[model samples]
Target: MSESLLAALLALLVVPALLAIHAGDLLLATLTLGGYGFAMALTWAALGAVDVAFTEAVVGAGATTVLMLAALLRTTRRRSPLPGRLRWAALLVVGTVGLALGAVTAALPPWGDPDTPAAVHVSPRYLTSAVAETATPNVVTAVLADYRSYDTLIETVVIVTAGLGCWLLLGPRSR
Candidate 1:
């Protein structure tokens, strides 16, 4: 992708995130978060991680937005105002964390740099040995199901647990 298009997608992510943060109405904030998630999905797609992009679109934009809307339907639309001091303190903490994360990103290797540790060490082994070792034709399948099975299983469990929690909280009362 062209630099301009990628920059625009990244900028799109920031705008909705800021809007969601400042939105007074809970519904508006939820919708804005969905927009942010969609922008994130697009950014991931542009970065050539289609699997991650699709997952983000479905879970982040689709399921999360729907769940928030359902929860809002069960209760209120307007957000309770935070005290001024509390708001300022929260902003300060968030800003500090954001700056720290940005600094960490700056210290990382460049995107897709071939000399990075993963590219230099791990990826070649996976590409060469995955099928033979795991008996899975697709390298990605072998990695996810065989090499990183526990991680994948835990991620699935987390998603399922979150869904179950939402359903228990938002489902109809057992009258």
Candidate 2:
């Protein structure tokens, strides 16, 4: 997609997020969260990350929205207004974090820069020897499942544990 289209898509994504955050109604915020996720999925698809887009559509929008709505149904819809001190404190903290993140991101090399450190140092080894070493046709799968097996295993374990916890807490309640 063109840069203009990407810009428009990002705007769409941000608007829903802002609306969701400011919404006093919990249910409206939850629905807007889903809209934000859908917009984000479209943005990812436009950027050629169809896998990420699919995951966002299912996990970010569908499942998350349903779960949030369920939780909201058990709670009050109108949000309790935040105290002025707490609100200002949160804005200060968020602003500080955002500035720090912006600085770090600005310092990083441009995306897909061939001369970047990771590209120069790590990517070639993966591309050249990953298949031979791991006997996997897909270099990415070989790197994730073989070369970084321990890391991948830990990540899987964490996700599984999180899912289990969510299921135990949020599954159909026994009468």
Candidate 3:
């Protein structure tokens, strides 16, 4: 993707994020956040991470939005306002974290650079020997299911736990 297109996508991502943050209505915030997720998916796609983009679109923009809207159905539309001091404190913390992250990002190699540590260290082994090592034809599948089995299992467990928690919290309550 061209630099201008990527920059535009990044800019688009920020608008919905800011809108979601500043939105008083929970519904509006939820919708804005969905837009932010979609924009994030587009950004990921532009960066040549199509799998990540699909996951973001499905889980971030789709499932998350549906879940939030369902939760909203059981709650008030408007959120309780935060006190001035607390809001400022939250903003300060967010700004500090954002700046720190920006600094770290600026220090990193360019996206998809072939000489990055990850690409140089482990990726070549995975790309060349994944099929023989794991008996999986697809490198991504082999990596996720075989090489990174524990990580993938933990991520699955976390997702399942989150789903259960959401269900228990949002499901019909008995008297």
Candidate 4:
């Protein structure tokens, strides 16, 4: 079979399996959520983002979902009724906004296209001058870890702060 045909068949099989995975049981629901995270990691890997895939696999499939399930285990097991009119209206508005944002994204430049202005402008200089300036073979690594180090450092600090906040909030509160 052709590669495209195999991929299409795999997607056809996977879509319904994913959609059918709703579970009233919290443990089963958590497993389903982790499965979804693993799927997302697979998608990131397919897109050539190994770093993102690794992070997603670790955080999403491993830590976050486990934490969620643990919290759920500590709470009540019964399912609650769906929210009322105000919440439905808010959800509708949010969905509409999300659809509009997705439409805008669909019109954006295709990734990694050399003809796109973004690819042309930022890429050429990095490719041409990175080795000379940094003595690094990987231009992307050099740019991310060196030239834009401040931005990366700030993002790391933000993540650490968020983790600390979560730990503090979830920790025991003494009277």
Candidate 5:
């Protein structure tokens, strides 16, 4: 995808995210949050991160959204409005953090640069020995499921635990 198109799509992602954060209705916020995740997944795929996009779609948008809705079913409170001063303070803090992060990112090596750490070290090893080391024909599968198994397993455990916790919190109480 063209950079301009990716930028446009990412810009759309931010609008839904802002609305989700500010939504007065918890249900609406949850749904909007799912949309935001889906947009992020799309952005990831466009940036040539298919594995990340798949994980985002499955866990971020799908499982997390379902878990949030299930958790919402156990809740009495809907909207908790923040005070004006606090909201402004939050906005200021978020803006400052975002700007700082952006500056740090801008200072990083350009994407796909041969001298970058991953390019210099990780890629060469993976490309040369992935199949021999992992016995996996596909390099990505080898890296994700074999070489990075612990990381992937931890991520799965966290998502499953969160979903299960929400499921357990479902009310059986009689009013």
Candidate 6:
């Protein structure tokens, strides 16, 4: 058989199996999403982007989903019916903001198009100079750790504040 025909046949076979596998319990759905993250990492690796694949495997597949499940366990596990007035107000505000954001996005340049000024101007200098300056292969790490270290420091402060807030709020009340 031709390569295209074989590819099409494989896709046809796999798609239904993928859909069928998710038609189970909530845990199964979460596990499936995690599996999809791993699959995405594999796809990234296949495309010669190993750093992205590693990020997907660690952050997406492992940390994020586990954090989500932990949050779910800490809060109520059952879904609740939406509150009436509050829900309506939230929906209206969200809808208006979403419509405005969508309009702004529609006016923006196309994704990854070489002609876009963003694609041209955003990171070219950083990409070129980062290796020479930082001696780091992962430009993202260099930028985050070195160039934007102040931002990371502020984020760490915010996280520490949040941790303290949670401890104060949820800790045992004094007798």
Better of 3 and 6 by lDDT: 3
Report the Cα lDDT for residue 107, model 4.
87
Clashing pairs in 4: none
Indicate whether candidate 5 or candidate 6 has the larger TM-score.
5
Deviation from native of the Cα of residue 152 in model 6, angstroms? 1.6
* Global fold similarity of model 2 (TM-score): 0.76
Q: Give residue 18's lDDT in candidate 3 (0 to 100).
A: 90
User: Which 10-residue window of candidate 5 scores lowest in summed lDDT?
Assistant: 166-175
lDDT of 6: 0.72
**Pairing residues by index, what is the TM-score of model 6?**
0.57
All candidates: CA RMSD (Å): 2.8, 3.3, 2.7, 4.2, 3.2, 6.9
Query: What tens digits encode model 3's per-residue C-alpha lDDT throughout 96-135?
Result: 9999999999989997698999889978999999978898
Evaluate residue 14 in candidate 1 and report its C-alpha lDDT on the 0 to 100 scale: 80
Error of 1 at 36 (Å): 1.3
Q: How many backbone collisions does model 6 have?
A: 0
Evaluated at residue 139, the lDDT of candidate 4 is 79
Go through the candidates in order and give each one's C-alpha lDDT: 0.88, 0.87, 0.89, 0.76, 0.87, 0.72
Error of 3 at 22 (Å): 1.4
Q: How far is candidate 5 from the true structure (C-alpha RMSD, Å)?
A: 3.2
Q: At residue 58, what lDDT does model 1 achieve?
A: 98
Q: Cα miss at 3, model 5 (Å)? A: 2.0
User: Candidate 2: where are CA atoms >4 Å away?
Assistant: 128-156, 163-175
lDDT of 5 by residue, 43-106 (tens): 9999888988999999899989997997798784387778999989998999999999999999
Q: Write down the worst ten-residue block by lDDT for model 4.
A: 13-22
